[model samples]
Target: MILWLTVVQIIVAVAAGAFCLVAGLVGRRPSDFSVGALALVELLLVVQVVVAIVAPLAGNPPTGDLLEFWVYLVSAVLLPIGAVLWALMERSRWSTVILGVAALAIGVMLWRMQVIWTIQVA
Candidate 1:
């Protein structure tokens, strides 16, 4: 795993979470700003996934279980898309809540990815 890239992903995810939370708290439905921010986050995650895959092929496999890491990566990539879909359908303040929760979940998932990347096996 590329350490700096992972750090960037974590920061972006957390920032997206904060943005969503504040929007939700203000009783705002999901807006272009929120969706755009999430899309950017998703884009970064896709880049991370590419790096994760290629780095291993280039002989830099993570220290942790590859399966676990892949699972986290895939889930992290899917989350924002799902949240955006749900928010578009719901079209209410609750939709913003969904986005907020999704953002936070992505943040946690990214952090977990970092843990998985660095974990040592006995």
Candidate 2:
């Protein structure tokens, strides 16, 4: 994974998570802003997926276990989708908090992925 891309993903995920968390704490429902923020995170994950695929071809394969990295990447991609679906169905403040948690989880997973890509020794 690209260092800059990873950094950007982490930043976006944290920002989205914090935004939803604050919204929930303030008793806000699952609004467009929260959903949209998750959508943006999802989009970045998709981009990261593409980068992960092409990076190896471009001579930037990960230094850690490929299976582990892929697992984290796939889960990170699915989390926001699941959270958004849950929020839509539940339509409550707690659902917004769930979204925030999911985003924060993705951020942590992204950090692990960066480590797998650049630091770990397979």
Candidate 3:
């Protein structure tokens, strides 16, 4: 995984998580901004996928089991999609909570991706 992009994902995830926590307490519903966050996550995920596909072509190459990489990769790609679905279901503060979970989950997956890369490199 690209370190810079992963860093971005971590930061965004943390922000989204914090947003959710704060929103849940205020008794306010999630807004379009929540969906916006999910959208951003999806955009970043797309970038990562592009990186994954192009890295090998560029000769930088993935440093792990291709199948496992793909598994995590697909999950990473799906998180935002799930978030969108969750948000659709939850129009209230609960949606933010769901988004928070999605963000945290994506961040964890990103960390896992790094770990996988390190293991493969070793």
Candidate 4:
């Protein structure tokens, strides 16, 4: 995984998480902005997936356990999707908070993935 891309993902995820958290705390329901932020995160994750697949083919394989990295990647992709679905169905401020939590989780997971990709020993 690329360091810059991972950093970008982390930054975006954290920012989105913060935005959703603040909105939810202020009694905001699930809205377009909140959902859109998650959508953006999802888009970035999809990009990351593509990069992960292509990076190895390009001779930039991870130094960590490939299986562990894949598990984290897959889970990170699924999280926001699940959160958005929950927000849509529940349509409440707490659901917004869930979205925030999911985004934040993704940020941490992305960081872990970065460590796994570049720092950890296989």
Candidate 5:
């Protein structure tokens, strides 16, 4: 995995999370900017998935458990979409809160993924 890419993912995820949280706090429903930011996060996650697939094939596999890593990656990809769907259906400030929580989850997951990628194989 590219180190800087993971760093970027972490930063974007945190930013998206913060965006959602603040929107929710302000009693705003899911707006275009928030949704766009969520979409941007999802796009980055797609890039991550592609990287995860290609890097290993190119002999840059994660040093930790591959299955665990893939599971995290898959969850990372799905989380924001789920949150968006839930927000759309609910259409409330709480929905924005859910999105915020999901984004934070993605950020934590990315951090864990970075740790997994950098771990030394014993």
Candidate 6:
């Protein structure tokens, strides 16, 4: 993955976390605003998926535990999609909790990506 792209994702994740925290505190559900924020992070993740696929094709296959990397990537992307769906169905503060979970998952995924990258480099 491109380093700058990871940085951008970090920023997006942080913002999403803040928004989710506020939404949780205020007892809110997903709206255009919350969904829009998640969309920004999702966009970054899509770019990451593209780059990750291309990198391996360009002779940069991951040297880390390959299964771990793939699992983290797939799991991270799925969380937000699930959150969106759950939020739509719940229509309550629980929806914000779903977003909070997504935000937290993103942060964990970011760290896991770094670990996988470092393992490859080492």
lDDT of 1 by residue, 45-71 (tens): 889888997997998778888888899
List the lowest-lDDT window of 10 residues for candidate 6. Answer: 113-122
Clashing pairs in 5: none
Global lDDT of model 6? 0.78
The RMSD (Cα, Å) of candidate 3 is 1.8
Residue pairs with clashing backbones, model 3: none
> RMSD, each candidate, Å?
1.2, 0.4, 1.8, 0.5, 1.1, 1.8
Quote the positional error of residue 94 for candidate 1 in Å.
Answer: 1.6
**lDDT comparison, 4 vs 5, better candidate:** 4
What lDDT score belongs to each candidate, Candidate 1 first? 0.85, 0.97, 0.77, 0.97, 0.88, 0.78
Off by over 4 Å in 2: none
Top-down TM-score ranking: 2, 4, 5, 1, 6, 3
Q: Per-residue alpha-carbon lDDT of model 5 for 32-60, expressed as tens digits?
A: 77777788899999999999989989988
Winner on TM-score (3 vs 4) = 4
For model 6, what is the error of residue 62's alpha carbon versus the real structure, in angstroms, after optimal superposition?
2.1
Q: Write the per-residue lDDT of candidate 2 for residues 1-122, one digit (tens) a residue.
A: 99999999999999999999999988999999999999999999999999999999999989999999999999999999999999999999999999999999999999999999999998
What stretches of model 1 exceed 4 Å from their correct place? none
Assess every candidate by TM-score: 0.93, 0.99, 0.87, 0.99, 0.95, 0.88
Candidate 4, run of 10 with poorest lDDT: 113-122
- Model 1 weakest 10-residue run by lDDT: 113-122
Put down candidate 4 lDDT per residue, 1-122, tens digits, no spaces: 99999999999999999999999999999999999999999999999999999999999999999999999999999999999999999998999999999999999999999999989897
Q: How many residue pairs clash in each candidate?
A: 0, 0, 0, 0, 0, 0
Off by over 4 Å in 6: 120-122
Give lDDT: candidate 3, residue 48.
83
The residue pairs in collision within model 6 are: none
Q: Predict model 3's lDDT versus the native.
A: 0.77
